[model samples]
Target chain A: MLQFAAIILLMLGLYGLLTQRNVIKIIISLNILEIGLNLFIISVGYFEGGLAPIFTSETPANPNFVDPLPQALVLTAIVIGVGTTALGLALARKIYQKYGTLNLDEMGEN
Target chain B: MLDNIEVLQVLEIVIAVFMVVLAFLAINSKSLIKAVMFLSALSMLSVIGFVVMQAPDVAVTEAVIGSGLVTSLFVFTLLATKKVGVK
Candidate 1:
């Protein structure tokens, strides 16, 4: 069920990315794409009734735990998404300032 | 009850469906601010969905950076452009 949702989210993001002409909307679409990818990574780490990877002396030495790798990877990806978003928005601001319009078609004309 | 896994699964699916609708609305909205608002709604739903998926850390990050920080950044940039000033 989770995987199905993730796929739909990915397709929605791709649709927005392909169809949107405004630079800010493009950046927003990129964010949606990042979210879908992140969700998939976290879902890959899930284990039924599994504990987090943290270990305490009171806990059993060998216990079921959700995979920590994908969580770490998604953490990194989320930060990178933020940086990319900031950069994209800055560029959009510059484009708007220069072109005085947010439409891609108009910006393309000289 | 919220403790039931089945209930949680149902809730997660509902949120995901809402997010998909919001994504389409966001990308297709004629007004840029309306699009931004839809994006904000999408971010909020994603945060909730992340929590439902057993990713509390990711949920926190998404809530702070995705919904709050990114929305502010969008608004700031929109203001910076004279053509999109506070509209």
Candidate 2:
């Protein structure tokens, strides 16, 4: 079910990317795509009643943990996602300044 | 698992569904501010889903960075453009 949601989110983002002409909208689509990817990665490492990978004295002996590797990858992905989002928004602002309009159709290819 | 469907599973399903629906609305919304707001809401919803999936680290990071910081950044950018500045 989680995978299904992820796939749907990717589809929605892709559709937005292809159809939307607004710069902010395009950035938003990219964000949705990243969110879906992160969700899918975490879902792959999840299982019923698995323990979180945090180790401490409070944890029990012989703890059954879900894959910690995917969580790490997702952490990196989320950070990269933030960086990319900021970059995209910056580019959007530059585009707005260049064309005096956020709509790509209005700007055209000059 | 089929023999006993847990409430947590049911809740997970509901959150995932809401996440997908919000993604749709956020991407396709007509207003830019509205889209950003929808995305913020979706991020918070995903944090809940992350906790349910046993990813506490991701949930904490997402709640702080994804939902809060990113939303504020987007709003700031929008305001800077003066296209939808304070009226």
**What do the candidate models score in CA lDDT, each in turn?**
0.81, 0.86
Off by over 4 Å in 2: B1-5, B85-87
lDDT of 2 by residue, A2-81 (tens): 77788788888899899988888888888888888888899899888888889989889899888888889988999899
Worst 10-residue lDDT window for candidate 1 chain B reads B78-87
Q: In candidate 2, which residue pairs clash?
A: none
* Model 1 docking category: medium
> Who wins the TM-score comparison?
2
Off by over 4 Å in 1: A54-62, A108-110, B1-3, B82-87
In candidate 2 the C-alpha lDDT for residue A109 amounts to 92
- Compose the digit string of candidate 2's lDDT tens values, residues B11-60: 87998899988998998788889899999999998888788878999999
What's the CA error at residue B43 for candidate 2, in Å? 0.7
Decoy 2 TM-score against native: 0.93
